[model samples]
Target chain A: MTTEAPERRGARTESPAKFRGNPWSGRVSAIAYPAVFLLLVVLLWWGATSTGMAPPYILPSPEDTWAALSENGAYLALHTWVTAVETIIGFLIAAVVGVGMAVIMVYSRTLERTFYPIILFAQVIPKIAIAPLFIVWLGFGPEPKVLVAVLMAFFPIVIAGISGLRSVDPEALELASIMGGSRWKTFIKIRFPAALPELLSGLKVAATLAVTGAVVGEFVGANEGLGYVILQANGNLDTAMLFAALIIMSALGVLLFLILEVIERISIPWHASHRNKDA
Target chain B: MMTVETPSPSTAVETDTLVDVDDITIRFDSKKSSVVALRGVSLQIQQGEFIAIVGPSGCGKSTLLRAISGITSTTEGSVSLRGDQVVGPRQDVGFVFQRPALMPWRDVRRNILLQAEMRGMDRVEARERCEDLIQFTGLTGFEKSLPHQLSGGMQQRAALCRSLLHQPDVLLMDEPFGALDALTREKMNVEMQRMWRERDMTAALVTHSVAEAVYLATRVVVMGARPGHVVEEFTVNLPRERDYEETMEDPEFHRVAGRVRELLGSASSHE
Candidate 1:
């Protein structure tokens, strides 16, 4: 009876998610579909530019953009590294500060009531509107750019972290109480782990926003970053160079998102969202 | 007048009384109004006894269990465990909730060892006990499986393992099998009876199923609705070693189940 248990259980398998064959195939298609769409879009853009349907000044040909990229590859790489550093540093700071504030708010009702409205008020102020102010206060370096990145990335992390903390099942809280675990122990063991799914989602949102914050700060004051390069190219009417910088900027955002995804998969393999990935 | 059956010597007068709930009145108060969940309820629990509190919806059966576990505070009177007043959550009490309440992040083994990890028990000893409990609970091969990977019944069984891992003196369960199907619930009832017989802890289970109350508990307390209080108590005199098939057929089981069901009928009718 014990030996047949696996076969029986396997036979009774029912998943709400559509089964799409082996994990490799599932992963391949997930990337392949988006890749195919992007390739088609590129082909259409190239065709349109070659046919002179859109003027070169208004919409530069793909070859022109690619030529500009290769010509300024070294310079672009340096700026890319700078922007990446500022965004990553800003994102890390936001994660720590936001999650810390959320923890304090969760543990103390007085703090939540006192500070949560102020946080909302701060969030309501457009981050871009304050970028010039940050440049004035902090000057034209990575400092102002990183500050803008932190500002853009902070709200979602704090909001999502608080919601995650609050989402812990009351039964689990009662269980913790019954087990006689201290309040601190319960937070570390039960409450925090329970909050991971939401917290990771918040981090992902912040990661993407971090790149925007860094670029926006650079646009306001920085002398050397992808954002600065874009501003310079735009002023010069080098649309091809502008397109190249924009492509690199988007690549940076996607890279951050993918890195967060990998971290999430490693840290929370036991989460329900990961159950459909392989056996 | 409601019936308050006199306690038989075998149950109420045991020397090693582990819990004494003395006229615990629980009231939920808001700004506008106050609602009484439990009113003047008293019960004494002996060591190694399996007591089931059965009632209709809205009765304070669950509130009583929480009061004993110190999860819910009593408005009046006190609950004493081992001769000491339970001012807050007592260390030697274990609770099993209506749902499994298993942490989605932890696998079966880690979830079972949660009790030990929280209490700062020795690491090696905790691991050994966790393995023993997994085997005992028939979750041996699935130690690495997450809660979502298991069936509802298996998840509840894992929860049972978690509650029992610490070997608390008293186990308080509020409808632990209420979410499972009938077949699984019956199997869990048999499993619970076996666990209860093997262990030395006192347990108070709040349930709505009459057959379950009669089959697993040594004594069944019937409670009424509105301002909930005890209506009647019946001592089940069935044999200790009871199987699902044979026990349900036994005349003694039928008699006790019938009486309890009839009492529940009258209690609900009054409301």
Candidate 2:
């Protein structure tokens, strides 16, 4: 039994280190693989365009796309800024409403039973299908786009928030009660902090969805934003301009995701997901 | 040395009792049926006494602990702490669960000081007590460390420190060291005994381990399963200053442990 115990422990401990490798070398390889893959993809695209295997009008050469981007740089930047503002505003509204609703639901089972199904049903309604309706109700401007973004981002936040709120260790709650911790005190100190990890994950999902929602709104009715630019480029058959607009939109999405990641790292260093990053 | 007055049999004992549980019955009503966890259970704990309750699983050991803390309401009878009926959770009674149950976000010091924070005690005094608790639990160096950073044993120690922060009159523990490894559990038993001996506190520990009950408790209560009730109580006649090496070798320890184990075995066999 003595020999068997050490052998079992050794087996359990050894595999993970072999798989993860040393931190320094692992970091280098992590960067190297992604960079190499990106370079190869760009090379293939350049080769396809340069060799005339793909038509310029269909998939414009990287240089043509770059030229289009530079020529209309100010216009694209303005649209990007408008879209970003709409996304941020919508995201803030969704977070407030979503978390508030979650708190109410978690606090009252009757409310949860009544509203949870309705929320789920609302989530299933295609936001894009209702985009035109939102435009008709609100307007052909940032308001419609912001509303759409909120609608898109609301469900995940509420679901995750509820799960997080309920996930507080029961023993912790009991301990608080025994310590004479008030309901508000328990909610603020124990429940909120514990729920943050799940809430942040929900927020991260919403961040990227916010961008898509804004662009969808712009596609339906807005006179500005990357979505409007894409529509115009498509109509004029300016593929390079369309490509440029698409690139900016994707960059916006990635930028929002990265920003949320940074916020998550700051807010929840105790979370297991951020442990390796802190290390 | 004092004059002996006419001592009433009931009042004298009642005044000395820190915790008086009188035939408390706990029933859980599910949709399908009613489950009786505890039936007509009575135990009176005096001040500065350490009582260990040992029983089979589903014997309502945890239920009784919760009853004392006022976390669970009894279906019948009453539980009184210091002669006052326990209606709901009270700050004067500290409770330790099977698991350490430390807050993940808070560090050792903050977690220990949580009781003080909840009660809105003086900040300076709370800090002093927090520091003393860290020292008492030998968690001085890891005050700022989060719960996950500590080992099972260390976290349990931090939890022990947290429960004792308010200097509660009675400490109710429900298998606090059940989650630890065997070696660590044994070590923690000695540590807990030492703490209990040093402090003027009433404690009740519920555990499934007969040996642990025999080792640490002043009185060991053997409980039966299925409508849990106290079957027998053994007063540990061993010396107070117990060491692992010496205590385990004591014949009285063996006798008490043997009796408790046999009681538990029979209790389960009847079920």
Which candidate leads in DockQ?
Answer: 1
Q: Summarize candidate 1's per-residue lDDT along A1-279 as a digit string, tens digits.
A: 132232113422564243645658777888899999999999999999999999888889999999999999999999999999999999999999999999999989999999999889878888789999988898887999999999899999999999999999998988888888899999999999889999999999999999999999998887899999999999999999999999999999999999999999998887767766643
lDDT of each: 0.88, 0.86
> Candidate 2 at residue B261, lDDT?
86
Per-model DockQ against the true two-chain complex: 0.57, 0.37
Give the worst 10-residue stretch by lDDT in candidate 1 chain A: A1-10
Q: What lDDT tens digits, residue by residue, belong to model 1 across residues B1-271?
A: 2354546533544688889999889999999999999998988888878899999999999999989988888999999999999888777888898999999888888998999988888889888888887777778788988787787888888898899888889999999999988977887888788888776557999998999999998889998888888888888888777888998998989998999999889888887
Tens digits of per-residue lDDT, candidate 2, B124-194, equal 98899889877776776788888777778788888888888888999999999999889878878987888
TM-score of chain B of each: 0.96, 0.94
Once fitted onto the true fold, the runs of candidate 2 whose alpha carbons sit more than 4 angstroms away are A1-22, A277-279, B1-14
Instruction: For model 2 chain A, give the 10-residue run with minimal summed lDDT.
Output: A1-10
